[model samples]
Target: MNSTLPHLGFGTFRLEGQTAFDAVSMALNAGYRHIDTAQIYGNEQAVGDAIQASGVARADLFLTTKVWTEHLSRDAFIPSVKASLAKLSTEYVDLLLVHWPLNHNTVTMEDYLSSLKEAQDMGLARHIGVSNFTVAQTEQAVDILGKRVLLTNQFEVHPYLQNSKVVAKCRELDLIVTGYMPFAYGAVLKDPVIVTIAEKHGATAAQVVLAWMRQQGYVTIPSSTRQVNIDSNLKADSLELDATDLADIAALDRGHRVANPDFAPEWD
Candidate 1:
């Protein structure tokens, strides 16, 4: 994983309409060069619009979007990426990810990985990766991808679901870990420890949580619809947490996960 990439990114999950567009614009203005979106989010076009509206050069930005679970097959994956590119109004994405480990219509590891390779070869996506994948599944991807593909695994990681095992495996394999839901879907904002730390650092609870993940060498994308939250989220990048602050937040772990859908596999 290249440490050069921005550790803090903008997440466009559950955001839609003019709110999503405005939030993305605010994020861009707040110095967020990385934007994480997905086909399922149905807001790639808005993200594209925001990028264009921001006047940021294509090369200066790191745009990531995912192939939906329904489009994981070899036959559908490449075309799906093309569709995403069209929606995003870009020729290539900085990173393209498989949104989930399982496909609705049954896709093998080989099938999905081969399609990812094809997407890369075609120059449709600059990098290939996966999201919501477990350690075993990521291992399977690495084994199947061999030396040709670089697999970045994105998951919901926060203080509650620290995801130590997956983070360790990713470290060993040199894969980038994108930590989504870094604020635990706003649940961690109310913690007294986080609030106290935020007050001491002159930051928000969200910034403290995001800064903790960034300090751990994981990429974090925390979503926000409000302009204040969007601006506050970007401040996480400049936040420096001491060892004691890290320990305090780390102790808040309760093994809670906020984004587990019924179709998603158990993360270990």
Candidate 2:
């Protein structure tokens, strides 16, 4: 149950087969200890293989996996997590998340959330939280769990989608906000605002965006298949942004979201 989470993590989304394996291995080689994946990714085995092959002691790494929508039932939850653990080749994950809030037409929040806590009690997960959850849903989850601490509420947060409302709620609840799609799938890389800032700081557009995320007190998981990009992203940990830089990036928000599915909740 490692409580410490790396501010910058390596994301594994839309990555599969040997590509996922190679990218993860390169990230580990580049000194990334936090790895983010999900049951929906269909590459957990590949990620697990990369971890085992990296020889980075399991204790030295922080691994997170999310339980998918179909597995949210009380009867299916724990077994789904066990299946994930087997694929990850680990006894337990540092943090586990609900991939999406249930629609409540099929399963209620209490059923799934209780299942999450039960998994923690069984030592299948060190911590638990939610993903793609709205502000109201975040509060409901907190109330449902009572005193159980939610380590983080992971959702979309990038320069183009600041997601301030949900972020403020997570902060108020004392939960860490982990932002996925930090680069907005490379769309922000071409933004003139980000480009100008990158030139001023002599940094890459990716680094500038990542620095914005870290400086805002949010954790970001950015992924890349190229070794150079993977190695360079880790350096964002030390890239500092001044007040002007922060404010400039803050104004770039256009309420753009990249991960919206038909099943997504009504956002804050």
Candidate 3:
């Protein structure tokens, strides 16, 4: 629950073309200052266009982009970040992250992490961290970076896939945990327990889950193409969950993760 990162952020994972542009523009208009995108998302330009069109001062925005696996090399890291900056239409990203750890040993931790630090030193990135990294990989990143700070370890955290092991490791390392896919790609929206809570609170199941995440003191970025949902997700911050609601949601964890790719590292 670090105040450094906005508690509720707008995610641009699958959004593209006019959808990406429109969604980002709506989010900015709806008061979402934190926007998360990555090179792999292929929507940075659209996101940038929306940011420019919104007329929100650059100083008021918190923009984040990730370095793709292919750009983890010493040679490609800095240049790739510059490309992302150009696409984002910003001189520096508020946060930069290693999107994922390489499945093979093609890029060493030392090389990529040093390159990440170098990017920050060069003023291309204001902060840096990792995503989809396992406990061991997170440890190695901290060791490699030494005194330099890793702001947050962003991975999947939701009612169904709590990912407590990695979350604990991040806590021990002093890295804030940013939970993406907080609704498990809409899978948790139909859960009977969540539904019951939603009815009790007179809120949507999605809002119930997002409020639970906020009560647990974790940052979550839930994306939506609908204007109502974009506005409603941010309103979860105002929804208060009592102890019983918190306990019910905590018991919903079933170790079900939804973001596993072939290249994902071993889970903790």
Candidate 4:
């Protein structure tokens, strides 16, 4: 989520095995500079393999990985990140996140946050942040990390799931907001408003959504397995949306959320 990180990133969520390798390899070839994966994604090895095979210098890429919830225990935290570095076959990741908060009360926020700081202190992670954390939890993370900048708060942000409360809270803290599921998992493509906007710009529906997010100053990661989609997504940064277009997209909010788990904390 830093300036050095690409505004659009290639996310490897469900991608695994050879499929993961092929997709990541294609993304790299298609000019993606930011690649996101997690310890729980079960494809860091494949991703790492792709990165190595791509022949792109590590310095030219922004890599991110998450510390799974199961590794949040004080003793296991740093070790898990180190293991993730190994799986990624890299010395360090540009950003590392707490995949999911132990908000169900399994672990103290202070403890896990402290562990995240520890990873950065040791240079295992260049930056640290949280994912799927509520606004209150994000505030607590800032407090725990102290002077260290909480680089980002990755959340679901799209026309359908417009999380204005979380967005405003993050900006108030001066923390970068990274929007995952920026396309609403293909739901945005079917919206008539989006279709109309796409027609006006001579762009695809996906391009309209990505452009809106970047124009609003939020970084987005919209995953795709196809080279054409990956290349097309990178160009969304060029599509300009007018005031009427933005308002229409804003009016499409229905509070629809994806990726909610039973153990998830209260949404802000």
How do the residues 177-211 of candidate 3 rate in per-residue lDDT, one tens digit apiece?
89999999899999999999999999889999989
Please count the clashing residue pairs in each candidate, in the order shown: 0, 0, 0, 0
* lDDT values, one for every candidate: 0.86, 0.92, 0.91, 0.89
Off by over 4 Å in 3: none
lDDT of 1 by residue, 1-268 (tens): 3554578889999998787899999998888899999999999999988888899899999999998888887778888898899888899999988888883437787888788888988999888888888889878788888743665789988888898888888777778888998877678888899999999999988888888888888898888877888887877878999999999888988889998888897678
Residue 209 in model 2: lDDT: 94
TM-score of each: 0.95, 0.98, 0.98, 0.97
TM-score ranking, high to low: 3, 2, 4, 1
lDDT of 2 by residue, 111-162 (tens): 8999999999999999898999999999999999974478899999999999
Q: Which model is ahead, 1 or 3, in terms of TM-score?
A: 3
Higher-lDDT candidate among 1 and 4?
4
Query: Against the hidden true structure, what lDDT does model 4 obtain?
Result: 0.89
Full ranking by lDDT:
2, 3, 4, 1
Worst 10 residues of 3 by lDDT: 139-148
Q: Candidate 4: where are CA atoms >4 Å away?
A: none
lDDT of 2 at 263: 85
The CA lDDT at 133 in model 3 is: 88
Worst 10 residues of 4 by lDDT: 141-150
